[model samples]
Target chain A: MAQVILKRIASGDKSAVQDCLKTYGGLIWSLARRMSPNPEEAEDAVQEIFIDIWKNAARFDETQASETTFVAMIARRRLIDRLRKINRQPNVDSLEDVLVEPTNDREQDLQVCVEAREAAAAMKNLRPEQRQILHLSIIQGFSHQEIADALKMPLGTVKTHARRGLIQVREFLGLGSDFEKEATV
Target chain B: MKDLQDNRLVELLADQSFFGLSAEEGMELGQLKKRFPEWENDFSLELTAAAIGLANLDVREDLPANLRAQVYANADEFFSEGATDQEVFNFAPSANKTIVSPPGASVAETTSGFSFWQNLGWAFAAVAGIALAVNIWTTRFEKPSEVVKNPETIQMPKPELTTAQKRDELLASAKDAVQISLTNPKNEKEIVGDMVWSNEKQRGYARFRGLPANDAAKETYQVWIVDETQDSKTPISGGVFDVDGSGEIIVPINAQLAVKKPKAVAITKEKVGGVVVSKQENVVAIAKV
Candidate 1:
């Protein structure tokens, strides 16, 4: 698929960009939105993602991953990188929620709810602290020691939580044990 | 590497923030991965890990048209002018550019020849255009200012928005629900979102913070208000407006008129196409408003 896009792009296929947007806009938007500080930022990130996609269309490798995933990953990374300059706040209790204007886009709402529920259920397996730690360290990607110092816990405790937390997550999904099995160097 | 029993390393792989790990941290994680092979290659966990960070957050798909044009204009100027593979996105210097121009293509088309690059260019261009369009489509057409040049040429109303205008603004802003979290404990640093339910302000707004910086060009969070007033089923729109993106801004909410409290308040990721129904994800931050 990427090869087709690459070939087509190489051939000056004008419609290819829209096709890519049609195909992966949602995925890229999702990934970019995660790292966006706010809606406008996310919107801007989407624009950048597409720009980067077009600029790099010649380099897409279909063999490496799905084109959707590839572009989405690129978008995801760009968003994350953009996020780095800003202070990595743990989570701001949404301040303006009290007055948020209601929208009428129901289907989109339902879709987001469905996906959010799935993601939330996966998160439910995590203990509140585990979830927080994971949110800070993994999702937000903080160092263990860094997390340890922030949370003011022993380094060992942080490690224990991460390991046991991961093990528990594996169990929550009802998978085999030994989730942290050794890797081949 | 075998004895890399550092359990802390295992935590890094599970972190969505693993992309920014330092070299020492990376080495440490790599060692742990050698000891725990599954850590580096857990697809299911990675999916969940990735999605979890994104959960409860909105992705904006609306691109203003002008921004799209600006990017395209720039691309044409810089990238199009260079016949080299510089447009090719190879992080490494040695990567070759792919040229897939269809047969019988003229050299004039060399700039956007790759059928896919053209698509790629259009996609970006689409976002820029959307941004411009959004800016234009958004502003209510007010009467243009008159009087050539007197200091007071224009009659400035003491108050810009009349009561009716204010109501209209509110109605417009009420068109979409801004995701918010009134219940979250203050001072918490997580990016908690909730629904914004109001009809006396702009047509759109969101109460959000803690998100990392990223381009939000064609992207905008939309409000979805479900109305069960007249009918037992089906929720309708209030209105739609792009997020101010400076923390939060008022947007019109759209739901059954006169219904202060709609059945449900929700948000969706809308497209530059501005569809009545969004074919995208919603953070699903449920709210009583």
Candidate 2:
């Protein structure tokens, strides 16, 4: 098994610090810049996110997720918290512009984890509106209201689409075991 | 695990992972979380979001070289095993400034910032110690300074010091100052910040990074200093403040009553203009001194 950088970090391995930074730094930096309103905020968010990562290094469970996924989870939570705190949505492309573009034709340079690839495939299986709503909410960071206004759908409808679409996606990603296990019990 | 079993919880969790939740929804989710203790973490859906976000990230930009260097330096200090309590709190003695410890305080009391990490569910509390002298000094020293025309003094452009800079200055000037990190005691783990208090100066400041901005008309954050000299049930009101923007915010602590010995500092969400005394509910963060 590959040594988890976070576990190494938890053990006070100074060398894992560099490895962790090198591995997830770009991913976090990109997420921050995309989610933040400005470059300076992005930089600050990056620092705070790194601090959170370091603090949470001991909590990383390899049985639950890959290191990249765990790091991404932390980064996303931090970014969302930041957005909620700042009362700002991600400075992403307009809904119209993004809707016109092919969502799958993203930059290939960034590494995609297995879950994300499966998520992408699952997204394709969603209804058009559901896919679009999920895309707007997850990728573009649009609030339900914002998505409703953009898509000219009712707010409740947008939320339903988002929730239902997400449930489907989660199930497709093999994350529906919670429900399955509970049902059997 | 029970989240998926309950449709409402699933909906809330899904909303949380996607574009986030409304204040009402968040409260509901938090309430629901109490019913399901096995819900160890809320980042499961966020993990899915991460995968999608990673798959679709427009560009993979490299971490700035300067940021990389800063991270390494901080990590070195943070992970250093031999660092003292002061160093852990980032309060090294300045070259020109003399170090003076706060009276009747020990190293253990001042260095409780790291305890937040070790102990989960530890409620954050604010500063303490109600000094009667602070009240007398304020009342007796109400004199306006007469402007003396000094042409010899160079009127340099004085750059406004940031809240962070002011915090550093307070730490440097007040040798007896205490700094503590604050965190949320609830399901939301993103809220984290620090409080710096100086009993001698009777002045303090709270700095927060992830505290949500509030609508001034609807709600505001009120700070409270739990003075050991006073009743544990009733803390000294540290005035009300608002977070207007993102990133680090520094709010000066405005203690209504003189604080002599603060055992903990707390911030609670109150109605507009704040209340005379908080019901000890809706507390956002607290730093146990």
Candidate 3:
């Protein structure tokens, strides 16, 4: 179905572009959510991704790859682009981390979008911003500027939101042995 | 096991990175790291429990950058004019208006006019045909991917003794002790100690302080490496002796390898110079570490 939509889009059918958006809208939103610092930045990333998909859909070679692969490549490219931008800022690690487990739901959600609903449902403990910040900073790597622009707030406001958000996460971890209580998280 | 680096420890404390570690859990990690010497041996269970206790305070700040659309807006304008370079024909801004198509026109009428339709018809047809033909031409584009015939399962190389590699890997995992703790069956409380690891010898040394004070020695407290690798084997000798005014003794290790990775560290009572394994004077009171 994505293949047909993309082919139609490449064939210059505007409605096919709309159809692609309709079907893949949730997928793109979830990806943006993973990448952005908050819901607002996610909203912006979603818009940017869609506009990019529409404009570049002509280059999509349907026979060369599946539509999911094509869309995923675009999403991953945009995400890595964001990561590179963040990497330009001061970073915490130059070496690769050796941890093996999927420490959070964002990883599971990113690997499988269909699982996001289940993951979100299972996210009983994380507060909204705690989930939002982890999704944005880790997955999206959006800078404070992008977050500020999306949120339409002062730079300090965005920083405060992120700082306060992390405190809540620390609070959750303090309450119990989250590592031992793996089933609950 | 390799020594945990400070930066790696910081990463472990980050929420995105080590979500598995709770704040209280991270506290234990931080506490041990703060107290232990930068490079030392004895990472006992007490240290781990202590690290877990301090886990609750770790926090990370990571965010994104600016996104401006002017560059994109310009690109959109360029592409809408076809893939042709707008920069090339800037002199003919008015001329572009002459070629604009009517809002509504029949398909036949649209193709009826101009040098573009008449002279460029063959070129258009050729491009379209090529576009369509490429699909047919590469009929077998899905040709079987060349398979690399490398062995799927690689056997792990057996560990070879290299004084250099051993020293380095140990340096990565080892830590230095800050204080020493020692106790005996009589003075079972208040044992503080410092530890160090020797990769070349495959052993760790612990120096004791405030240990059981013996007078001319009937018997002294012994340190043993509770060997965990050999089926939770008996506690093996790590040199033992009485402490002087300084309360210091260097113990040679046989199986403190368990401390590098183990359930706990057990202190036992024994004769001087130590024995091969924990005996009748076996494990006095084990430190939970």
Candidate 4:
């Protein structure tokens, strides 16, 4: 069997570091660049992200999520922490810069690709306003108030759309309804 | 009957997974999970769906070449330090079993040389002491399986060294390594590179120019160290990596086994995440060592 990079890294194989960077550099780099306020901050965040990965390499559970997903989770957690640390709200100008188009790359895992397609399809079932609100809140990293301000909607309406839209997506994916029924019983 | 309360709970769970929750909300989430174990699975699936949706953004961009160099240098320093620590505490017996006599101990106070048999007895005791120490140390701290299961216990503090300093250290260590220039067999002008390998040190670096970056989702570039000394025809794996841009890229060579006599190094395009044994049908470059 091909050696898992994280397993090798946990065993102190120095070369696995290079292999890891080569494998996930683009993903982390793009995430950091998009999330950070500037290129320099993105570069610094990338370094921190790698250090975190090395420290937590052994914790990676292959059965629960793909390596890409695991790494993405770490990257997002660090980026969000940084965002919160700075106490800066998501800029209105940057909202337009967020990439909204979905990719049809065949290289993604079949399961992930299918899930992404389903999520995208399920999103289309939402009202355009709810869909836009969720995209801003989830993908753009905007708070409910910031999204409301950006869209010129009432704060309560923003929260309503975000909550209702997310619940709809979860139901569409066939996840929340069963749990909800079971919980009430 | 799922009512307003149920809808509110679903919303809270979704928000918690997406952007994190406040302390009170987090406590509430814990209570909810404890009350309904099924909610945990539902939460995981929701998070997975959210991640998938985000992955569809296709926001990949090439990192700056200098940043890549810094990352490699930092990793090299970090792992090398770890190896040095392990060697000191875990490998060397003499270091672990230094014999120190108590103050005014009669055995060391006598300067006269002892008989050969007596010296041999002392040596055996020292060896036994080292063995016991090693056993206790390994059992206490170096359990590989435990480390894999709980990485938080082994995480070290980050080093404060600068990137340039780490890169300098890495290059200084590899200064005596041999360098071999690689060429693209099909089109020499299109892909070209060199590999710097130190057989004694069992480490090497590869630098390539003009090799186009691949879509890592579809394919990745795999490195192979062809050691003719090995009985098997299969070359030792040098690990799989991907290029992100058309410029020069420096990659560390990760040989899966000890390379006795490396005859050549080759790079091939393989499926994403790479392969155990490359078919070598799509060889991009080769360096005859």
Top candidate when judged by lDDT against the true structure: 2
Candidate 3 wrong stretches, greater than 4 Å: A87-100, A103-185, B1-289
Fnat for each model: 0.11, 0.39, 0.00, 0.16
Best by DockQ: 2
Worst 10 residues of 1 chain B by lDDT: B91-100
Report the C-alpha displacement of residue B143, candidate 1, in angstroms.
Answer: 39
The count of backbone overlaps in candidate 1 is 131
Error of 1 at B209 (Å): 23
Can you list each candidate's DockQ? 0.13, 0.18, 0.02, 0.10
State the weakest 10-residue window (summed lDDT) of model 4 chain A.
A94-103
lDDT of 2 by residue, B60-140 (tens): 446654455444434543564355543322211110001111233222121224343322211110011112212211222
TM-score of chain A of 3: 0.49
Model 3 chain A poorest ten-residue lDDT run:
A92-101
lDDT of 4 by residue, B1-289 (tens): 3354455566566565456666788788777667656555554434443554354444333454446544553454345443444433332222122242223322222123434543443465466564453333333333578667866533332333343443344457655568788899787665498877877556577788888889987888888888865433456667667899998787766564446678888999987655544667899998787
lDDT of 1 by residue, B126-155 (tens): 444433322321121122332333323222
Q: Rank the candidates by lDDT, best first.
A: 2, 4, 1, 3
Query: What DockQ does predicted model 4 obtain?
Result: 0.10
Per-chain TM-score of candidate 4, chain B: 0.43
Model 2 ranges off by over 4 Å: A1-3, A89-98, A106-109, A180-185, B1-5, B22-24, B80-82, B85-289
Regions of candidate 4 where Cα sits further than 4 Å from its true position? A1-16, A54-65, A90-114, A167-185, B1-9, B27-46, B49-56, B69-289
Native-to-model Cα distance after best TM-score fit, residue B51 in candidate 4, in Å: 2.8
